[model samples]
Target: MSNISAAIPPVRWGILATGKIAALFAADLALVEDAELAAVGSRSIESARRFADTHSSGARAYGSYAELAADPDVDVVYVATPHGRHVEDVMTCFEAGKAVLCEKALTLNADDGSTLIEEARHRGVFFAEAMWMRCNPNIRKIQDMVAAGSCGTVGQVRAELGFVAKPDIARLWDPELGASSLLDVGIYPLTFTNLILGEPTHIVAAGIKSDRGIDVSGGATLTYTSGAVASIAWTQMAWSDNRAAVSGDGGRIEIAPRFHETTGFSHARNWELDEFAEPVLGRGYAHEIIEVNECLRAGRTESALLPLDGTLEIMRQIDEIRLQIG
Candidate 1:
């Protein structure tokens, strides 16, 4: 824990998976003033116990997700399973009456995303896909500026993300597991364009599929109703610039490479450029953790900043892109 955010009462959290992402989130949750890592769950009781001991003292350890979800002390559950198991894992939490903030690319496909959101709505529980970028303060500032026409008449956008996947990374290259560069890394750039430009009127995409048939690299062009267009690309074979930009008639906003977790962006207007940086709380994960806490505290089932509708729309677009690439 670094410095605690003031006045937010503790919200006990149960993590429903013992994975790398689970550990990262558990550490960040400690930085939140209102967050308590109350429980951890894994297929093996010993695994859960080990994770809890490392992340949260006194946190209960459950041998199964069902037990974790049923833990009465837990206020919410964070699903950190791989994409293939998202639906089943999320259902466990939802049906258990626990609020949830599941890791993103919320599900393997659009229908699943819709199904999850519908269930959440029906359950009247606080639910959110952990698309943490939407909660970054500087990203929010750029969004505000773009909406206010700071980047006048935004005409075009571009974003790219790429990284090499080790052969041992089972989830990155396994077709049966819904492995694809688009879902794993491309979602960030796709969501970036979608946030700034809204839904696309026309979407054109292409992919370089691997021997196993999952996309290893790809690109997309999205044209919006306002004539604004976006170009995005991703690859799992090698690292690229990983940069994003939004250009308008007046100027452009340049997001630093690896923009998804970036601290700031540069904007130029009327031939002058200015840089803005808003250092996020705790590796940029605390913002979303706080957002979830706030939503639960306010008795809200949905977040206006990261709405379910948007997640579904992106999943739909992803479906279309994958089909085109195939």
Candidate 2:
């Protein structure tokens, strides 16, 4: 945990890309007291100005991402571009000596993810993957409880996340954009399972791919050395329950529907059930912003809650899954 001091100035953020996710992140930045949207960047000048006008009246708008990276007032850049462009965009921020909070699935594969991490290390700049679910208060609480034996010797895990994505969405169907149901939604269940089971000793996966050679639905079973097993699934072609559970000999923990952004969960043990709830700020993105702010103030280069090595491991897992399914 970073030692946060009230004396530290607010961390200035630069948004690189005016996409839907980027807009949501910009809105959530207002909920963090120690974070400020200092700039907005887009390929088009008009788009940049529009986003800045809507999200932050005082923020500067840049027609090019390089201009935003070069801004002296910007302390960190949020790489909100598509996963396919992460390596290039993040490198731009690092070149400017600015910290970064990149969107999840850090890149198309672990190799590119490692490349960005190496560059960040060489530049001595703070860098973190924006895996917001790991930073959620309720998720963290569940992790703590499980670690403290509240869940009692976990043995099995099951999780799934899916939604009916429209066919017209280019980013969802375009192979060049790095579109895949696994990369978009499967990552959540995979991360959730890994959090409970650690690294898997054996992985068996199968999936359905689109005609464009992108995975649209998939499932994987992971076996651990502890004899524990996890079954996870994801899809972009249908709406799933989006619930997750961890079961052990002692008890079971049930996360609410849409587990990734869930604000509450329940624990059942010995015929007694207990409910737990936590406050989620601004659609649950504020927690990550708060984390980044704290790390910046404490001069930390990586977030403990969302470690870089963990991100790399998850990327490698995704790589293996892709190879198996492809």
Candidate 3:
């Protein structure tokens, strides 16, 4: 716990894009005290200036990622580009001696993730895949309960996350965008399942690919060594129930819409609700920033809430599911 409590340097963050998710994260980061939006860089200077004006406190803005990464004031960079662009974006930051917090699916596959991790280690800089959901305080509480046998031996878990996504888009449906239910939406359930039940020994999956040859919907079942099973489903072509449930011998845990959002959660047993109603501030994304700040202050590279190894293992499972389905 000493390392956990050690003083972390205030991290100067360089944001790498002005996309929707980037805006969301920037807004959330603004709510945290120790994080600084020191700079923003985009392919277009116009976009960079616009984002900086709107989202930050007049931080340095650059027209290119190279310039942003080269900024001496920037201690870390948030790689908020699209899935396919993740590799190039993060690599640029690492090459510039900047630590990085890359978005989910890390890099389209396990191999790319390994490369990035190794590169970060070799450079002696912090590197983390921004699987922010795992850092939510409520999710961590739920994990604690499950691990403490509060739910007894796990029997089965079911979770799903999906939203209606247009078919004609360049991002969600375009095969070149690395678009797929398996990568975009499926990663949520896969991450949640791994957080609760650990890695599965085997996985069986079926995918529904759109006319554009991208997976728009999918379902997967994982069988674990402890005989616990997790079944997950994801879709982008249409909206789903958008709920998550973890069932065990003693009780069940249910997370509501946008389970990753940390709005609230419930626990029940024997047909009676035992616990309910815990709320958090500011969209719930800020906690990950807080965790990152705490780690940086403590001089740690990886977060306890979202460990590097756990991220790689979850990515490997995603790869396996893709291989099994297609």
Candidate 4:
């Protein structure tokens, strides 16, 4: 737990779900001084209690999400359920008058996201998609440099993110669970491209379907209005040499591990590799926690780093790709 920023008033947090992603987020939150692990909720009582004890001693463990959300000690909730369950779980928090930071693939589709967003707006509560990579300091630095025209007149950006999937894993293979390589893994590369280029005017995609009828591997080409293009690839059938590069008239920039982890970028003109490392509290996930704290402090419900509009646009593209492949 590195103290990258001074601890502000601690934001009491209720963690919903007792899954791998939930555990990762809870561990990360424990590293942030301004983030309090107030409660953990799971459908199973034993799992909820175990998760709480493992990450935060004396933190409340609720047998149900409702119990966690209604806990007066909790100021906000983090939803870490699977993609298909996002809308129901997130809406449970919002309906209970709790602010939410839900994990990405915000919902199964755009309509569900719009419904959640509208609910949050009507309730006057904060709602955010946990697009953690967008808040990573190194990623932000790249965005800043690009916006500053450091990479001048961006030409083409290419990014790929993939890892071989365990064939028997239900979440990765189940179609009824809204599983797809495009949503689960493709989103990372798609998002990486969109982050730098904004909404694409044209998107072309192709993919091989899984035994369960989900995308197992795929590629996409997104063309921006500025005539810039980004090509991205994702796969669940095999591991990829995941990396990202953006080329411009003036120079090119490289992103190591492109999707997650500590990112380092280099500009081709200088021909020198420079690493921009930011202090990450726990396993580098505290950056998003800090972002949430800053937004809450500023009385803002949405974040500019992972803005609502950007989320919607990206989801629309994902939906389009799924349709095209289907």
List clashing residue pairs in candidate 3: 7-297, 8-296, 8-297, 8-298
Error of model 4, residue 80, in angstroms:
0.7
lDDT of 2 by residue, 173-201 (tens): 99999998999999999999988888999
Relative to the true structure, candidate 1 reaches a TM of 0.96
- Writing each residue's lDDT as its tens digit, candidate 3 over 139-199 gives 8889998998877899899988889986556778777778877788789889999999888
Whichever of 1 and 4 has more lDDT, that candidate is 1
Q: 14 in model 1: Cα distance from truth in Å?
A: 0.8
Write candidate 1's Cα lDDT for 95-171 as tens digits. 88999999888998999999999999998999999999999898898899999998889999999999999999888
Q: Write the per-residue lDDT of candidate 4 for residues 197-304, one digit (tens) a residue.
A: 988999999999966688999998989899999999999887888888888887777877744554456666656555556555566667888888888878898888
Which ten contiguous residues of candidate 3 have the minimum total lDDT? 1-10
RMSD list, candidates in order:
1.7, 2.5, 3.4, 2.1
Model 4 TM-score on a 0 to 1 scale: 0.95
Residue 45's lDDT in candidate 1: 99
Sort every candidate by lDDT, greatest first. 2, 1, 4, 3
Instruction: Please provide TM-scores, in order, for all candidate models, with all chains considered together.
Output: 0.96, 0.97, 0.94, 0.95
User: What's model 2's lDDT at 111?
Assistant: 94
- Tell me which of candidates 2 and 4 scores higher on lDDT: 2
